[model samples]
Target chain A: MAKRPLILVTNDDGITAPGIRTLISIMNTIGDVVVVAPDSPQSAMGHAITINAILHVEKVTIDDGPQTEYSCSGTPADCVKLGVREILDRKPDLCVSGINHGSNSSVNVIYSGTMSAALEAGIESIPAIGFSLLDYNWNANFEHCKSFVKTIAENVIKNGLPKDVVLNVNIPNITKNEIKGIKVCRQARANWEEKFDKRTNPMGRDYFWLTGEFVNMDKGEDTDEYALANHYISVVPVQFDLTAHHAIQQLNTWEFNS
Target chain B: MAKRPLILVTNDDGITAPGIRTLISIMNTIGDVVVVAPDSPQSAMGHAITINAILHVEKVTIDDGPQTEYSCSGTPADCVKLGVREILDRKPDLCVSGINHGSNSSVNVIYSGTMSAALEAGIESIPAIGFSLLDYNWNANFEHCKSFVKTIAENVIKNGLPKDVVLNVNIPNITKNEIKGIKVCRQARANWEEKFDKRTNPMGRDYFWLTGEFVNMDKGEDTDEYALANHYISVVPVQFDLTAHHAIQQLNTWEFNS
Candidate 1:
C-alpha cells in the first residue's frame, strides 16, 4: 500500500470559516490532513508575522472529520511557521491555504493573507497553493469548487511546483457548469484608486476609512484578470523573489560615488 | 533657479526615531520635505493597511527642523496611502522611506514595513526608494551615510526609476573609509530558520516567542547579500509584480479538465 501524503491546511478567514471548512473536507479525502490556522479573521494581512508578541496555539475539534486542527493566535504567516516548527511531527508533503471568501487575483495578491500563508510555506520548500472565490458572501457556493480544487491539489501532489513558486488559484463566482477550465496567467498591473471617507466622531475628532476601487491597467489577454473575466479559473504561479533583475544593469549606470 | 522638488519622507521606526530624523535632515538639504510616518514602531508589518479600523493623523513638531511632520496611527503602507490621498496638497516628486535600523536585504524584503512604504509609493506611480542601515541600534551613525544618501537621492531625482520598480538600498555597517562604494544587485535567496521559545504563562498556558537565525542559501556574487558582505552598499531594484512568468508555460501544460 502506498503511504498517504501528509497535507497541512490553513486559511485567513479563521479556523471555523466556511472557506476553510470546505478546504479541510476536500483535503481529507486526498491525504492525511492537519490544520493549523488563525483563530480570528486575518484578511489582507500580507506576509506579516507576530514578532513583538507571544503566540498561542490551542487544539480543538470543529467538526466530525479525519483532520486534526489547531487554532492559532497569529497571522496567516505565523500559523504556517508554528505549524511547521511546533505542531507537525515532520515536513508535510503539501500545504494548502484558503478557498478565501474574496478574490486574490491581480494586485490583491500583494495584500492577501491567504496568499501569504502559501508563500510562507513555499519559502520552507513545501509544495503549496492558495485558493480564492470571487464571491465575498459567507455562504458563497463552494459545492462547485470541490472537483476543480481536488484536481489542482492532486496535480500539485503528483508534480512538484517550480522552485520558489506557489500557485494563486482564483475561482470565478459562477455555477460548476460555467467554469470552462483552468488557465495559467500573469498578474495584471493594477492598483486601488483610494478614496478616504472622512467623518467626525462624537468627541469632535476626524477619522477616516480606507476604501478603494480596484483599477486594472493592463489590457493583455494573458493576465489573471482576463482569465477570471472569461469564466476560467485563474492560476497564476507566484514567487517571493521580488528582484527586478532586468533593471539592475540600468541602475548600475547611475553614479553613486560623489 | 528651479523650484525645490517636494519630497515625502517616512519610516517604520516611528516618527521620532533617529533614522527618520536623519532622513528628514538629509531631505531638507535636497528639497522641500513633508514627513508622514507611524506614531509607533511598525517593524515587520509587511504591506498591511488599516481597513477594519479608523485611522488618525496628527500634525506635530518633533524638533527644530525645516521639514513638516505628521504622526499617523497606522502601518507603513497605510501612512503612504493617507499621505497621498488626504495629507499632501499635491503629488510629491519623490517618496523616500526609511533609514531603517536593520537590513532589508535578501528575502527580508518580503517581511519589511520599510520596503512596503516604498512599494506603496511605486504603485502610485511615484518614484520611490527605501534606505536601510545594517546597524540596528537606535543611534546608528548617519554621519558617514549623509554623502552616499545624498548622491543616490540626487541621481534618482535627475533620472526617474523604471516603471513598476523601486530601489532597496542597504548600507553596510562599516566606517566611511572602509566602504567599497555601491553595487547594483539582485535579492539573494535567504530565509530565517525559526525557533519557537515555548514557555508557560501565569495561567499555565503554553506561549511561544518567534526567534530565528538567518540562512543565506544562494552563493551568487551579484546578490545584495554578497555586495553588503563585501562592504559595498547594495541597491536592488524591486518590483511588486508577484507573477512567476517563466513558470507560466510549464503550468499551462497541466491537465485540469480531468
Candidate 2:
C-alpha cells in the first residue's frame, strides 16, 4: 500500500471551532492528520508571530478522531511554525488552514489570520491553502464544503503549487447543490473606510471601537469578489513576494540624490 | 507661499522611539508634520487591527517641535487608519512609517508592523513609505538616514506611487559617507528557520520561545537583501494585491466540480 500523506490542519477560529473540526474530519479521510491551532480565537491577526512572549502548547483529544490535536497559545502563523518546527518530526506533505468563520476575500486577506497561517506554511516551502466561508456564524454549514475542500486539497498534493504560492479559497454561504463550480480569480481592489465609534468610559476616559465599511472599488469580473457574488467558490493563488516589479522602473525615474 | 504638504509619520517602535523622532524631524523640514504612532512598542504586529477591543488616542507633546503628535493604543496599521479618518482633517500628502530598529527587508516585510502601516496608507490610496535601519538597538544611530529619508519623502510627494503600491525601504547601518546610494530592488526569497527554545516554567508547564535563523535562498543581485548587504539603501515597491497572477492559468486547470 502507498504511504498516507501527512496533513497539518489549522485555523484562526481556535482549535475547538466547528469550522476546523469539519476540516480535520475531511483531512482524516485523505491522510494522517495532526492539528496545531490557536487555543482561542485569533481572527484578523494577519501574519503576526509570538515574539514578545513565550508560547504554550497542550496536546489534547477534542473528539473521537484519527487525527491528534495540539492547542497553542499563539497567533495562527505561530501555530504553523510550531507545528512544522517542533511538533512534527518531518515536514508535513500539506498544510491546510481554516474553514474560517468568515470571508478572507479581496482586501480582507491582508487582515486574515486564517490566510496568514497558510502563508506562513507557504513561506516554509509547503503547499498550503486557507479555506473560508462567506458566512460569519460559528455553526454555519461547513458540511456543504466538505467534498470541494477535499478535492482541492487532493489536487494540490498531487499537482503541487507554484513556488512561494498558496491558495486563498473562499466559498460562498450556499448549499453544495446551489453552488457553482470553483473559479480561479484575482484579489479585488477594496478598502475599509473606518468609522470610529467614540465613547467615554464611566471614569471619563475616551475610547473608540474600530469599525469600518468595506468598499470594493474594482469593477473587474475576474476578481474574488465577483466570483463569490456569483455563488462560485473563489480560489485566488496568493504569493508572499510583495514586490511590485512593474513599479520599479518608474520609481527609479525619481531623483533620490542625498 | 503655497501650503506646505501635510505629512503623517508613524512607526512600530512606539511614539517615544528615537527612530520616529528622527523621521518627524525630517518631515518637519519638508512639510507640516503629524506623528500618530502606537503608545508602546508593537513590533511584528503585521496588519492587525484593534477590532476585538477599544482603542485610545491622546494628543500630546513629546518634544519641542512644530509637528503635532498623538499616541495611539493600537497596532501600527491602526495608527494609520485612525490618523487618516479621525485625526487628520485632510488626506496626508505622504504617510511614512519607521526608521525601524531592525531590518524589514526580504521576507521580513510580511511580518513587519512598519510596512503594515505603509500598506494601510496605500490601501487608502495615500502614497506611503516604511523606512528601517538594519540595526536592532533602541538607540540605533539615525542621523545618517536623515538626508536619504528626506530625499525619498520629497520624491514620493512629487511623484505619486502606482495605485496599490507602497515602498519598503531598508537602510544598512552605516554612516552617511560610508553608505552607497539607494537601489530599487525586489523582495528577496528568504524565511526563518525556527528554533523553538522549549523549556519548563516554574509551574512545570512546557513553553517555547519563537527564535529563528534567517536564511536567504535567493541569489538575485536585484533583491533587497543583496542591496542591503552591499551598503545601499534598499527600496522595494510592495503591493497588497497578493494574487499570484502568473499562476492563475495553472490553477484554472484544477478539478473543483461542485
Candidate 3:
C-alpha cells in the first residue's frame, strides 16, 4: 500500500474560520494532516513574515478529527515557516493553504496572504497549492467544492509540482453541477482602482477607508479571469521569482559610471 | 531645458528613518519630490494593504528639505496607492522606494515592503525602483552609495522602465572608492534557513523570535547576489506578474474531475 502523504494545511483566515475548517476536513481524508494556521485573520498580507516581533504557537483541537492542529500568532507566511522549521518533525510531502473566502485571482495574488503561504512552501521545495473560492462571504458555502478539492490534492500527491512553482486554484462561486471543469491558466493583467473614502473623526482628525474596483484589462481568453468567468476552476501556476528575465538584455545595454 | 521630473519617494522604513530621509534628499536633486511613507517601520511587510482598518494620513515636515512629505498609518504599498490615488495631483514621472536599510536581494524580495511599494507603482504603469544597502543597521552609511543611487534613478527617469517591470537595486556596504560599477542582473535563488529563537515568557508562555541565515543556492555570476558580493550595485528588473507561464503546459495535464 502506498503511504499517505504528509499534508500541511494552513489558511489566511483564522484557524476557526469555516473556510479553513472545510479545508481541514477535506485534507484529512487524503493524508496524515497537520495544520499550523494563524490564530487570527491575516488577509491581504502578501508574503509577510514576523521579523520585528515574536511568534506564539499553541496546540489546539478545533473539532473531532485525526489531524493535529496548532494555532500561531503570525501572518500566513510565518505560519508556513513555523510549520516547516519549528513544528513538523519531518518535511511534509505537500502544503496546501486556504480554502480562502475570497478570490486570489490575477493581481489579487500580489496582495494575497493565502497564495503567499503556498509560495513560501514552494520556496522550501514543497509541492503546494492555495485554494480560493470566488465567494467572499464569511458563511460561504464550501460543500460544493469539497470533492474537487480532494481530487486536486490527490493529483498533486500523485504528481509533484514543478520546481519553484506552486498552484493558485480559484473556484467560481457556483454549485458543483454548475462548475464546468478545471482549467490551467495564466494570471490576468488586472489592477485595483483605489477609492479612498475620507471621513473626519470625532476628534477632528481625518481618516480614509481603502476600497477599490477590480479592473481586468487583459483581453486574453487564456487568463484565469476568463476561466473563472466561464464557470471553470482556474489554476494558475504561480512562481516567486520576481525577475523580469526578458528585460535583462535591454537593461544590460544601459551605461552606468563607476 | 528638459522639465524636471516629478518623483514620488517612499520606503518600508518610517518617514523619519535615515534611509528614507536620504532618499528624499537625493530625489530632490533630480525632480520635484513628494514623500509619502509609513509612519512606522514596515520591513518584511510584503504587499500588505489596509482593508480591515481605516488609514490615517497627515502632512508633516520631517526635516529641512525642498520635498513635501506625508506620513501614513499603513504599509509601504498603501503609501504608493495613496500617493497615486489621492495625494499626487498628477502621475509622477517616477516612484523610488527605499535606500532600504538592508538587502532585498534574491528571495528577500518576496518578503520586502520596500520592493512591494515599487511593485505597486509598477502595477499602475509608473516607473519605479527599490534601492537597498547590504547593511541592516538603521544608521548605515549612505554617502558611499549616493552617486550610484542618483545614477540609477536618473537612468530610470531617462529611459523609462519596460512594461510591467520595476527595478530591485542592492548596493554593497563598501566605501565609494571601493565600489565597483552597477550591474543589471537576475535575482539569485536564495532562501533564509529560519532559526526561531524559542524563549519562555515570565507568564510561562512560550514564544519565538524569527531569525535566519541567508543561504544563496544559485552560483550564477549574472545574479544579484554575485554582483553585490563583488562590490557592484545590483539592479534586477522585477515584475508583479506571479504566473509561472513555463509550468502551465505541465499543469494542464493534471486530471481533475468536474
Per-residue accuracy of model 3 over B1-258 as CA lDDT, tens digit each: 288999999999889999888888888999999999999999999999999999999999978889999999999999999999999999999999998999999999999999999999999999999999989998999998788899999888888889999999999999999887999999999998999999999999999999999999999999999999998899999998889999988887877753
Q: What TM-score against the true chain A does chain A of each candidate get?
A: 0.99, 0.98, 0.98
Candidate 1 residue-wise lDDT, A121-206, digit = tens:
99999999999999988888898999999999999999889999999999999999999998989999999999999999999998
**Model 2, residue B39: what's the lDDT?**
99
**Candidate 1 wrong stretches, greater than 4 Å:** none
Identify the CAPRI category of the predicted complex in candidate 3.
high
DockQ for the candidates, in order:
0.89, 0.89, 0.89
**Tens digits of lDDT, candidate 2, A50-166:** 899999999999999999999999999999999999999889999999999999999999999999999999999999999999889988889899999999999999999998899
Query: What TM value does model 3 have?
Result: 0.99
Q: How does candidate 3 score on lDDT?
A: 0.94
Kept native contacts, as fractions per model, are 0.88, 0.91, 0.95
Q: Please give the CA lDDT of all the candidate structures.
A: 0.93, 0.94, 0.94
| Tens digits of lDDT, candidate 2, B1-258 | 278999999999999999999999999999999999999999988888888999999998999999999999999999999999999999999999998999999999999999999999999999999999999999899999999988888888887888889999999999899888999999999999999999999999999999999999899999999999999999999999999999999987777673
